[model samples]
Target chain A: MIIIGGTATNGIDENLSKIISVPLLKVEHKVFPDGESYIRIPQHITNQEILVVQSLYPPQDKHFVELLLILETLADMKNNKITAIVPYLAYSRQDRRFKEGEALSIKTILNAIARAGADVLIVIEPHKEEELSYFGKEVKIADPMPELAKEVSKKVEKPFVLAPDRGALERAKRLAEQLNAEYSYIEKERDRDTGEVRIKNLPELRLSGKDVIIVDDIISTGGTMIQATRAAYEHGARKVISVAVHSLFLDNAYEKLINSGVKEIVTTNTIPQDPSKVAVVDVSPAIARKI
Target chain B: MIIIGGTATNGIDENLSKIISVPLLKVEHKVFPDGESYIRIPQHITNQEILVVQSLYPPQDKHFVELLLILETLADMKNNKITAIVPYLAYSRQDRRFKEGEALSIKTILNAIARAGADVLIVIEPHKEEELSYFGKEVKIADPMPELAKEVSKKVEKPFVLAPDRGALERAKRLAEQLNAEYSYIEKERDRDTGEVRIKNLPELRLSGKDVIIVDDIISTGGTMIQATRAAYEHGARKVISVAVHSLFLDNAYEKLINSGVKEIVTTNTIPQDPSKVAVVDVSPAIARKI
Candidate 1:
């Protein structure tokens, strides 16, 4: 099997190399002055099962388009089978059209990727499981949150798992179960017009003498994490940390999170930011076994 | 001509109805349970010269995509001509790929709108004129800065035009020439890695008893405006006011600007924000003559 990793998949590739003995080939991506992207596989991989990994995070459309282009190039290069490993799928939040005249952008994005030539697709903890049909791939991975939390717990002692909001409670619960730690979720009231969320009933879950770890599937804007950290500190948490499957870290998000009271944030190498720490889980091995 | 307006368009239809004897349509947009968007136009607009006015300011992408879908629906309804009047165009800052592997998303967005079936486009004082080619339309217009400055000058007997940065000196000079006011530009130093900018030099441009008007094309974070206001107040200005063509105010931007000692903030109804004051310019008259 030949493996190609995007900005997010580098960690998965490293872990997979250590787990199994396989030859890997990395794709080099560059952009021309005229604003076109160029992608090339350095080594020949005729009839090889290729695993192309990428995360569709913020700037969702651009990253999704780049991934499609990469898949198209690999297909044309005569790769036997193509598997897409997307850690954090963008447009997942946009699953359905709430009103008339709105395009089902998530469906459209998925169709673009499938049409570009991905035979199997793997996603980790999608916002909604029903979105799986959007992809024409045969394989789908759901909820890698347990394994990720287990890996995080191994490094730290007495880690208390936290969910920034009730919407993220399921993932936090699953992670806490795996880590054998206490788990609690914060409630939030969001302003419909502005998309501004206010955390409520947060100080109730006092973590006065515990090492807290905020766990979520994705961190976009980092607003929730910041609010959670402030509440945690006010309620007397010893130290606060963050771990997520996807660290989207939107514009100025990293600095905001760090300045908001998070001692150290750990996340998978999901979106190619400097603060992305801890690469505990790898999907390449699972994909290889499934295929 | 058929006009569609909403909060995003700031009742532009009401203004247009006075000039032309055409039916005015108001667009109603709402969010559904599954976090999807819904849009409805109250009147029939088939085979009409349709003008859909909207601004993509804060909640930038959501409002932008909503406008695109509305345009698509209008095209599907067999409108004879579709013109999109976006006064406050967001993501224009990403015109160039500042870093490696970054996409020129502004162009992609323009292409998406064009593909969605907008025959002509109108924007007010885009950050750069070179971005006009990115759109596949001709009905572009400059901000009514001169006219607006004259009106503002009438309010304050003695006024001085100040450019927030050297990049905006031309605009300040133009406004100053129109109002016959003194003009000055701030020298700024931006940290490349963090995107943090600081004023490098203040050359003591005395405004001891004069009303200072800081002018710019757009205000996204309001950081520059905040610094400018502080500098103006420290320099003994009697009053400090901020005026911009497009107000792409992000989260907490308005509050931050207000707290930074700005006496009054004035912007054209480019973006539909409650804080926006003064709308001296209208593109409808100019666009009507052009088309």
Candidate 2:
């Protein structure tokens, strides 16, 4: 197998190579004077099984277009089989229309990827699993929960997994089981008329002097995590550690969470992050196991 | 008619509205912690003929996603008619397979845009006209040449239009006719063996003491324009001004062209530019005339 890494996934090729033996290809990219993407692949793969790795993270559109150009180039080269490994899939949040007139961007993005000659798509914990078929390709979803749980285990002793809300209970339960710790979820209530949200009944699990590990699939805006962290502190938690598969940390979410008394934040290297509260764990092993 | 503007097309909305007399809707957007695009269209656009103005230029992927979101939102909102006005269409260069097994990115992009509920796509001077049908929608192409010619008329005296190469002679001829100026094309020769390029024949039109306007649809990389500029200077042209519909001064192309002694560069407001070599002229009237 031949692995190709995009601009964001530069160092990741080494990680994937450690798990699976493959020759890695890197994209040489430059922005043209007219702002057009100029990409050149140095390696040649005539009839090899190709794996293209790129994360649709910040500067999402540029990375996405780069991926398309790479895929198109690979397709033109007549590669035998192609697998796209997108660690962080952008536009996954709009899986369904929340309200009338909402765009389901994920569906359109998936279709474009599939059309770009991606035979198989391997994503790590997309926002929703139900919409995986939207791409109309062979889809492989690698869950980073088990891997994230392993990272959480090393960070704290006397741990208790807390789901940010009821929706993320499954994630919390899985991580709790992996860590051999107690698991519980907070309740969230929204005022139907005013659209004001407030955290309802706290978890029944005793939180006093325990390392509270908040497990969620994604940490966008950090509103839910912030609220849960505040509740955890109020309920007598010793150290609040937030763990998620993807850390978008939009705006001042990380700063806000740190100020809200959260001790640590651990996330997978799905999205690019600067070293701070973000503890990026490798998910290559999980992807390699499936491959 | 309801006009909507994407992030890049904010100021252009007011210009478009001034011509069409419509309520302008702007998408308030932010990146989520998880890198998901959070877009909110403030205006109500139910059952109305909606025109969304977005230029898919640099950061092509993000702008493309925004356009998709807006289209999808309008679709979900059950808008009567959705018209997407993409000033600078990305992925237009790869309209056809240059080699076997090419992915044909433009076709996929068009399909995605069509699926996103863009009933009509209004583009200004896409790379090619033949592939417009690939969109499978009511595609209205608005040419900004006349408007660009009007801008050129004010910029120079004793103007003579010069196509950088033979292929763009048609465009140069059209613009020259519009400006009532003499037109000619330079001959370019590429060494098939060494892959080196050289300008062979200069234009027959005497370039001495006259404003020589180089015209083309696109000015990517500015290699051709730079070559043309050098040849014009060598042939004793008094002033050299480059004109194009899309000015994609990739990398140091802009600086290189300016250094090569081109007097001024004028491009339509199809793509964004800084206040330097590029002078952007508004083409809203052209689009509005069609609407």
Candidate 3:
């Protein structure tokens, strides 16, 4: 098997190779003065399994174009067994049209990806499962929650997993069960007229001296995580830590989360970032199991 | 025939509708919080001629993604006779690989555009003509030098056309012939080892009271144009004007060109910009002729 990394997935290619024991294919990604993207794979591979590692993070559109170019180039070289491992699939949030004339972005992006000649797609915790069914080709989803739970267990004492909102309750419950710790989810009530949101937690259970760990699929903008951190502090929790599968960290979100009193932020190496600042645990073990 | 304009080609849609006398389709292009592009045509397009006008300029990748989304959406809607009218086709410059393993971005982009379901393509002044034949589908190239020359004739007095370098001499000659003005091209000698460039102009030609117009296909960094303008000034040109098919205007390029003594700059409505400042001459007339 050969591993190819996109522009953003620069150093993770070596890490993936270490887990899977595959040769890495070098790709030269170039961006012109006009903001157009170009990529070149120095060698050609035929009749071999190829794995493309690209996380659709910021500059998602550019990375997406580069991904398509790589896929098409591989197809041109007659590589049939191509798998795209998009850790954080952009456009997964807009799985459904919110309004009458809204475009379902996820569906369009999926079709584009499939048409660009990816035989199989392996995504790590896509925002929506129903959107995966929309792709006509083979798809394998890798869940890193178990790995996240293991990391959480080693870091904190008497860990209590908390979901920021109801949408992530399943993730929180699974992680808590894996760690043999207590789990609870917060309810968000929004005043439609005023556009105000209130976070509600279970009144019976107390979080006084427990290390609270918040688990979610993605941490974009960190608004919900910030509120949840403050709520945990108000409930007299000893420590607060934020854990997510994908760390988008948009618009000063990392700083905002830290300033909001979260003890630490841990995420998988799905999207590349500074390792020292944001704790990026490896997800290659989980990915290696599937391959 | 139905014509639709993207975010960059806003006002130009109405102008095309007037020239070609076709109803314009409305497209709602939205960028989601997670940086995903969404585009909706609002109404279903059936068995009719469809034309989409979009320019791949700054934010080229996003516009390219949106263009693909629009094309794929049209395909899903079963629109067969879809034509893409990209006034400024990005990635046209990187038509071929400079190195052994470099990606032919234009070829990949063309294939992507075709797969996304464009049956025909219409472009104005793409950087290279040879690359257009690589597309399996039909392609139409429109040259609006006569129109740009007309715009220049009205703005300047006793105009003298000057090509930035040897490559653009054809454009300068055509525009000069149309305007019935004197024309000259700058000679560039590059040091093979050092890769340094020197611009040379004829010492015999005098431009003491003539308006000098420098014509080129694209004005990327404004370095060549600045040098050409300086050379024109040294030859005693009274006023200097710059003309291009596509205006990329990279990093302080507009300010650099203005500061270099160009009186005014004129470009076609290819790349989107403020009409009051950039002097975007309409290309609807040229497109209307092709339709």
Candidate 4:
């Protein structure tokens, strides 16, 4: 297998080395003044199975475009098989058309990626699993939340896993099961028009005097997490920690999380950061065997 | 005069009513899941002097693109004159070409807005004055920092304006003079490669037991303000406040500032928010005469 890593996937270089003997190739991206982008794969992979890893975080379009360019380049190079590992798929939120005349943009983007020459696609805890049909060949990765929670449990005594909202309760429960800890979720009501979220069932959780870890799949605005952490602290959680699979950490999310009573934040290498002091687990090894 | 308010400029609606008799118009934006955007004006704007008030805050590209699309649509509608009131211009940090072949992206974006049909462009204390040339427009709005400072003075007691960085010191001094308050600045060293900034001269300021207000043109990442607030608290500031002409509080910046010991974060209606407490001081009476 020949591995091609995008900018966000650069950290995977170390992890890939531990499991695979294949050489990891770096894809170069050059963005132009007119907002045009060009991508180049460094190694020759003709007739070879290729694994390309990229995270479609913010500046989402730009990164997604880069990935598209790479897939096109790889396909033109006649690579035998191409697998795209998009840890944070950018358009996952648009799984359906909420209004008339709006394109099923998520489907469109997926089709674009598939047409650009991806034989297989991998996404982590996508917003809606039904959308998996959008991808021609889908490979879903289990949430790394369980692994992260277990890791946190070893360091902190009396740790509990917290899901910021009900949508994430199952993931938190799984993590709790792994760590043999208690689990709970915040009941949230979000106003779609304004993007405002209100926590309703937060005060019901028994959080007093316990070390809590708020777990979620992604941290986009960090607004939800910040509010949840504050509520946890108010409910007497001695220290609140936040863990996520993909730290989209959009905007000034990291700073906001840090300031919002969160003692520490742990996330996977799904999204790269300078101060990412958490377990960097690779789904590639598990993925490689299946592919 | 016809008023066009962008999302951020919504706060200026009250002031516009007091100054002008014309009805205020709104530009609507629709963002697709695939990160594509569309914009439309509420009514016909043919041959009218249109002033668009928009603050380019977080999800920076989304807001910037929405502004651009509005400009394009208005131009297509043959508006007599178009003026963009951008209180907080995003991408101001990338004013210069740090690397060869790199786009002066900010300039390119400005030119795109101009091409989209802006007759005049108004900005509040742009990162650099010379950037005005990039707009290719006939009218420009320089620092309204002094006007904003006067407003702050009326609200606070013996407030001193402190520039978060040396680059902003001149504006701070201008505000200090207008408010009859002391002025100071922190020297900053920025990493050219990563766009990370570090404050070097923060410790030298003796803000102990004094009410300190940090003033700047724009707040994007909020890192500088966070540092300044921390340094102020360490130096014994009784209370720390922050004011900006354009609060392009990107991401979760507003929440971060509030959590970081900012007693109050006051910003002009340059950007609209539920938390926005200050509206732009209409220099329109003065500005209208010049145009």
Candidate 5:
């Protein structure tokens, strides 16, 4: 098997290459003066299993177009197999229409990827697994939560896991089980019109005299993380660590989270991550196992 | 047919609405803080023919995604028919791979639009008519050349049409015939690596003692137009006019062309043209005929 890393992959593809012990193929890519993406698979390989690693990070539209070009070009090359690894699948949150006559953007995007010719699709902890069904092919998820839990355990001996909301309680439960600790979720009521949220209740444990870790699938604005950390400190938690699979940290989210009194920031290298500021965990081993 | 205009339509849809005498539908669109596009079609219409007028201009991918969403949603709403009008089709210049192991970007993009549920696709003067074959469905082109020629005839008498290269000689021929004038093309050799071009030879008539109008399908960066205008002046032409169907005028192109001794800049309102600087010709009547 050979790997081809897209320009937006950050460093996850390199990690995957190291873990899988496979050679990474070089791709020559450039943008024309008119903002058109140009790519070429310089090496000649026919009937070989190929893996494409790309993450739809910021500027998602441009990255998505490039990914489509790569997939289409690889499909025409008569490859034995093509697997697309989009660790941070942008637009996954728009899996369904919230209102009348709304478009399911995630569905449209995933379907287009399948049409672009990917034999298998792999994403890391998509907003919902059901969205992958639109791909119409074999789908796998690289869950970094277990690895994140392991990393947290190495730092804190016994930790209580807390989910910012009930929607993410299961992730908190899984992490707690791995650490042999208690888990609970906070209740949050969000005003759709105003985009404001209010935490309804705190955990039963009150997190008193205990180290707490908050887990979620993604942290876009870090708004929830900030609020969750404040609640943790109010509940008498000794230390608060915030962790998410895909840490977007958009528009001062990292600084806001840190200012909100987070003891440590933990996130997987799903998106392009800054390890100096956040403890970046590697999920390549888990992804390699699935592959 | 009811018209639905995207935000990036640049008044073309309104022109289409006026020409077709159809009521335009209301669409509310916004972007989330996380940079996801959200759209809501407020009105309900079923079993009515729908025309979607969207121009894939600058920031092309975002507009393309919105087009897909609109088409997919309209398809689900049981519309009798859906016709997509993309005036300035982006990525059309990449119709085919110029080198081995390259992606046919235009084909992938066009195919995706069809897959997104556009029943009939209508584009305006695409780079190559052959690229539309990738749509794999009913297709129509709303050529604005005739309308442009008519408009130009009203402005200048006895225009000598000249194409920058042999590739666009056909366009020059059509424009010249509409004005009852002679047509010729310049020979140009382009350096693929540096994207530089040099005019090898001027027209046989030397363009002496005649008003020259240089025509092309699209003018991006205005590099070719500036060079062609200089060549026309060097040949002792009385005045030079630069015209194109889609006037991108990117990166100081407008200023550069005016400084290059162009008497008039005429272009269709294909890519959000600044009407003050260039003589904007309307092509709505031409598009209306096909609709």
Candidate 6:
């Protein structure tokens, strides 16, 4: 059995190999003069179990194409045991066709992965688990919430976990169990007429002197997290820390969160993170245990 | 039948519709704050022939993803008679695995397009006709050589067409026939010992002080065109003009061609072209005749 680290892994594949004690084969890649992606596997492995680790980081489309090429090349090599590990699946949120003629983006992406010949699939805390059904393979979930909770606890003493909405309540429950702290959720109610959202139920707990850590799966734009953080402060929480597995701080979201009185924004190495912009905690150990 | 222009079309789709006398429905697209590509098709027409036009320009992978989304979205809307008109087919050069453990990149791209549900595909002068086989469907080629010849002829009198190599002899023959000019090919002989190539046959035409034109399928990096231009000037030609269907002037190739004393560089609007960099000729009329 061998593992091949793809170009889009963001160094997480190296850590995954170390934790799992597996031989890792790295794929060499470069761009041609005409701006085409070129990838080549260095070592030849025949008829053996192979793990392909790649992430859909931005230049997300380029990374996604690399993953497709890697999987298809492995399949062409007669390696039917290829397992694709995409840390954060791109286009996962575009699963629904809310409008008249919108693209079923994740359906197309997942179908392409299957067509690329990945026998098994693994992803880290996808936006929704049901979206994985589009892959049409034996899919495994790699949860980084528990590990994130454990890591964020080191920054704040006695962290109280909170979920931004009901859909993310399970993530908060798992993290709260890891930290052994009280957890609650903000009930968000959207005005159907105006499409404006307001938090319905902020817990009336005596959270005056406690540190609040809001946990979720992905934090892009930081809209919901910022609102939840403000609500926690309104209830007299000492500090507000935002934690999630995938942190795509799009459009200066990290600065916006900090400006909105968020003490610290912590996330895993799912999407490539800037250390100075957001605090990163390792989630490779959690993935290693799953694989 | 109606046409829809994609974001990557670079005005070719609009010109195509105008030339073919078909209504054009432009696709609405934007990038989300999280760096995901979003596309929506407005003005749906059910059970009609839909022509979707896009190009594989730089940031090619993103454009490819958009193409897939458009095709699959049309398929989902029960539009089975969808025709995908991609001006330039990327990854076409990576058709063969020259080295061990290398990807047949074009094979993966073709297979993904097939899975994306494009019923018919029309491509402008591909790298090789056989590369289109990876698409596994009936593909129509839109040759712009004759049209480019007529356009380039307006600049010089009594042009002599020359092929860079034997593989591009057919392209030169077509263009030469259109201009009623004599054409010859440069024979490239590679040293089996060191893999160094040198031109064996430079045309020995009894032509002193006449315009020489070099035509090929694609002009990428402009290496062969520059070499052929110098050879033409060495043969006592007055001026050298370079022409091709697809112009991917990668990495200062246009400047290199100019520095080599090329009088004019002409190409079609297959890939996105800067007006100041190279002169673009219209090829939409040829495609309209085919369709």
Q: Candidate 2 lDDT, tens digit per residue, A60-166?
A: 77777778777867877874598999988887877886754456778767876887779999999877788889989799988777788777888898999999888
Candidates 5 and 6, the one with greater TM-score: 6
lDDT by residue (tens digit), candidate 1, A44-115:
556978878777765553456567656766765664698887867776776665654445556655655676
Instruction: Tell me the tens digit of each residue's lDDT in model 5 across A1-291.
Output: 999988687777888899989988757889877677887877666798888988898788888888998888888888558899898898898888777778788888898888888899888888887788988899998777778888888767558899998888888987888888899988888788998888876446578878899998999999889888988888888889898999888899999998999888888887878888999998777789888
User: Please, what are the lDDT tens digits per residue for candidate 1 over residues B15-35?
Assistant: 666666566777777754323
Q: Model 1 — interface RMS deviation?
A: 8.6
DockQ result, candidate 3: 0.46
Better of 3 and 6 by DockQ: 6
CA displacement after TM-score superposition, residue B50 of candidate 1 (Å): 2.3
Q: In candidate 1, which residue ranges exceed 4 Å CA deviation?
A: A1-291, B17-21, B40-47, B189-208, B233-236, B248-252, B255-259, B275-291
Please identify model 5 stretches exceeding 4 Å from their true place. A189-196, B189-197
Name the best candidate (by DockQ). Answer: 6
Top model by lDDT, which number? 6
Model 1 clash count equals 4
Q: Can you give the lDDT of residue B270 in candidate 5?
A: 70
- The DockQ of predicted model 6 stands at 0.74
The true-versus-predicted C-alpha distance at residue B28 of model 2, in Å, is 4.6
Candidate 5, residue A54: the lDDT equals 82
Task: Report how closely model 2 matches the true complex, as a DockQ value.
Answer: 0.36
lDDT for B92 (candidate 1): 73
Poorest 10 consecutive residues by lDDT, candidate 2 chain A: A31-40
Residue-level lDDT tens digits of model 5 in B139-253: 9988787788877887676579989888899889888988899999888887889998788764465677888999989889998889988888888788888889998878988
TM-score of chain B of 5: 0.94
lDDT of each: 0.70, 0.81, 0.83, 0.69, 0.84, 0.85
CA-based DockQ, model 4 = 0.02
